[model samples]
Target chain A: MDFQTILILAQDAITNSAIYALLALALILVFGVTRVIFVAQGEFVSYGALTLASLQTGVMPGTVWLLLILAFIAACMETARLLVSGARHKLPGALATILAPPLAIAALVKICTPLHLHLGWQLILTMLIVIPLGPLIYRVAFRPLADATVLVLLIAAVAVHFVLVGLGLLFFGAEGVRTPPFSDAQFTFANLNVSGQSLCVYATTIVFVAIMAWFFNKTLYGKALRAVAFNRNGARLVGITPHLAGTFSFALASAIGCLSGLLIGPITTLYYDSGFLIGLKGFVGAIVGGMASYPIAAAGALMVGFSESFSSFWLSGYKDVVVFTMIIPVLLWRSLTTAHYEEEE
Target chain B: MKQFLASISMLAVLAAGTAAQADITIGVNLSSTGPAASLGIAEKNAISFGPSVIAGQKVHYVIYDDATDTTTAVQNVKRLVSENKVDVLIGPTTSPTSAAVIEAVAASKTPMIQLSPGPATISATDEKRKWIFSAPANTTIYGTAMINHMVKKGVKTVSVIAVDDAYGEVSTAAYKTLSEPKGIKTLTIEKYKRTDTSATAQVLHAMQGNPDAIFIASSGTPAALPHVALIERGYKGKIYQSGGAANAEFLRVGGKALEGSFMLAPPVVVGEQLPDGYPTKAEALKFIKAYEAKFGPRSMFASLAWDALKIVEAAVPKALKKGKPGSEKFRVALRDAIEGTKGLKGAGSVFSMSATDHSGVNQLGMSLMKVENGKWKLEDHAEFK
Candidate 1:
């Protein structure tokens, strides 16, 4: 309970929360524009984690930065391909594009094991394929279903969750893959000692928040995106393709998910189940953040993270109780407030 | 055509009765896939191996996948009992699922060999429950063994990191009670989610307390490498783990870190080199060679399953003396035969059983092994209390 211990633990919590925030924001972005939810976002996160894990294990000889750069480039190319292919048609184009990454990741995993690549590198390669592939999925899967009922779209989202979950188990197996330990750099101010890893994760999340805020505010595309969110028909009448904006939102969300995967990857050692747990927490954060408010969502994620850490300090045996208890009240309050807003509007 | 059809119906009825008489049905109600597939596979293989080892009886197994869930276990057990009319039930691996099936199996008056660990609520205690017999070695044995060792070693303080489940909780509590009287103080005990693997922070916190050792009670592969991780951070102290880490997978996962580290195992099941001309050792060696040839390489989990099945094989002759194999009388007879066995030789070692002693095997037969080149080699053997 000394200050140094407190600081280090707090730093770890913040870093974790920041990563959760990035993921929640990405999820929010998809929901905001597409009026759809994708549960398979965790697969993309796993991809990033596995990528790093694969690289570190000497399975891949590439440097960390090189791996990151190559992955991003590959992602960009895949996104472009998805956008162009799904541009004109609706049925087959969308289906093909949406299903490609998962299929590719599965193939890569089967090959990588015999190749003697590090588990970390294999994970990274998978991430590289998955996160970039998310945008294409939105372009293909969400756009065609745009005119469908919310219930149908929700069902599709649930389907996506199952598909990803099934694929994850099929490829990765059910066990949690062990991650090799890495060194942590320390940052201290009097009684606080924050590890370098936590700091990096937090900083990355903040950077994404600022960049995304700028994207939505300063750019012409951002304005159009906002207009689509505000009123799709009005935006369409004004010559903006609301559907295209929806695709862009998904792409942005996918990239953020990649970052989230990398940051939180070490905390749980990359596993298929990480998606469901992290996704649930991210959704909780989104709800607390007003569902539509990016800043509020970020704040809510951080709050949840802090409460989880703080409660662990006191309620050692029932830390989970502390976390969910706090979330329930906040969620209830948010729901009541949102109801009032709807009535007022 | 009508006369021919009547003749065929009479022939089919006679064939069905003869077929029923020819085979003794054994139902396997364990998971075949999912998270606990390894354990399920072990249980299934063991049960299958039992029939092969049996001298003269033709045992047909009806396998059902429990999917590692309690509700599924109940449904499968009922199906096996009512529909298949299996003579005896062998499994429902892991604690929770086995507990769920206990009520059904006991109510039906069906004899069962509960092949699971403890902390799962048994529908009835030892006195009340006579029909159901656990092959034994519950959490109490593991906890008591570790506590006894720690006390003898003059260990004064420790920290525990256990999986947040009934098995882990029971062992942790038992350890705490045993540790206190011996003046072994616990610094900070942490419970981790079964799926969680990140223990560095927990380890660091435990280290901060500067306790004498750290007791890891997780059954996951993630917990296996903590010895290496702890060593990496420059902490030099004794490390004690639950029976979960006694398997070969831990050695493989931890590699050099596991060398010189101690594990509590259930006797030396597999031979320590080739033993001198004993038929049991020879048969075990043959099994090892055949298994290696077929499966490439298997962990200790596979070996344990192999031995468990051998026990079943030894009991079949006396149990099946009755004319009808599926009769309740046959099952009870089988259970009694299994309990009465003593100094039974197998691949693992000599194991004995009695009605009161269910685990049939305990740690006294347990020899301490160390990881050498990622393979476990015997280091020390001690008698049990």
Candidate 2:
């Protein structure tokens, strides 16, 4: 490859990797802390997009910033209510608790018609609503199932997926809901042409990811959540209630997914079914990083993103067949290497 | 002895005359679900319209649902012929299933009148295959006519995005043949399956090439509007929608986004003056008025079905009178009536089908329309010169 071409492709890969990284990392976060594989995580991404689009447009007008804040607040509140209610009379720890967040969102959306939302507003609303989703789902569904086997929680995740899809179709008709375009402005750097909205997406993902990393490393609650992810029972023994920290982890993870949703709308049009593909792609990213490590997961996402961009550039027609085919072999190699790593440890 | 012999002779003549009538059965396989439900529904309704059109004919109808699958289509054709004993068969809406049905019906030596975009399986070259017929323009005709229009508009560079099935592949092939020599350069070409929702990446690839025009080949709702996002991205390039998006529903969903967008399709009534004393035009307006009154004013497919029904109606009576029910003579008469039709007016267009061409509307009358006032309004009618 030419040096300039390589450089440009690398930049494009980095951008692609970052978007995938955010979604993958968020998915892993919910799983790592709550031990519940939340399948509805993808739906939250779509919900975030639709929400933001609705709020920013005069279709459901308020100040952009205000709408974002309100959407975020509403997301967290909804999560809390769902988790609390789902756990009310159930067995203290069951898989059902881990799925409550998605269930709640589905119910909420099912009850209300999708607002005719603009693309920008959709981005904002979806992002705002996603911040608290992970925790809410974890608190209700996974917390009760925290002590349950991984397979059991996996089954619960599948259930969450069904509910999310069913509700998405039931509420938003099984067709594309178009969002109007953002303003047109382009910035060229070197050989790459970047649009104004795309730059915002890149910047937002970075800022959000950085702030999250900082919060995890520095804050008391974030530290508690990390501790729980490290050793759940141990954290409980040390005076941290795993239940609350688990919820927080889920919320934070879901918020990241929401961020991915908001960022995607301007660059790509979205529909209810669009979430499943991205979600599956994120899963690939998470598995590439070994699924247990955030930094590594992000690295894997970057690698996948770069490879995709590279394939698209060099072998455009076979991009899909090339990218998807790589997944099986990469996964096998990763698993084999991780086994070796564990043996060494 | 003489009287007895005369009576015996009279009884034998009467018995032989009574044995001459043979019953003919026609099988119709159509979709009841999936994206083409409305089209299938109208066509199925047209089956009923057949009896009404021929007020005195009693032809047996055998209808089955293909359910929009190829395997099911093949199965249904066999069922209709072997079990239902149909002498003739029609339909299976889309190209893929239509192709399967055509092959099966041809193999069984049963005459079939398929409703499809003739490109998927049976081609004009394959017309010698005998016992097969199409009631729509082959992809070659559509692609050639559409290319001719583009060439007329001075569009020399074109980009194509379409579903990656027989219809898209064939249409693209035709476009390349007709446009390349005319100095039309195809910059970006992409294909997606009918089920794909994410056209962003593919469309983005197409936009990168920066062609003067884009041709979206897929007629399904999913493929229709993703280009709108490309338009939003500040691309002012002309978009030539295929014959598929010419439907009113597609326009309604695309709304203001589709304003001034052009299409290549058969003519539909959009504020055109009716010819005096044309029965089809009056019937179409009445049906439209009734449908709008009952179904909230967006009844576009109703008229097309009504026309198809009228075709069946006009054929049935003449066929019934020409031969007894189920007779070869009766079936042949029906075919002649359908094929010989000319200048028969309907709600959408004045239609005529000939033995050489099953498509009622011709390249001579392709309807060109533009999105105006949030609805599809006919801009002009073009005849191949």
Each model's TM-score? 0.80, 0.72
Q: What's the distance in Å from true for residue A220, model 2?
A: 4.5
iRMSD of prediction 2:
4.6
Docking class of 1: acceptable
Summarize candidate 2's per-residue lDDT along B143-248 as a digit string, tens digits. 7677776777888788788766666777778778878878899987877644333444456666666788888886645555456645644567788777765555
Candidate 2 residue-pair clash tally: 26
Error of 1 at B226 (Å): 7.3
Note the chain A TM-score of all models in turn.
0.76, 0.74
Instruction: Quote the lDDT for B10 in model 2.
Output: 96
Tens digits of per-residue lDDT, candidate 1, B142-249, equal: 666677777777778897877778767887887887778777889888766654323444656677768877887767565654455466455677787676766554
Please report, as a residue range, the 10-residue window in candidate 2 chain A with the lowest summed lDDT: A58-67
DockQ of 2: 0.11
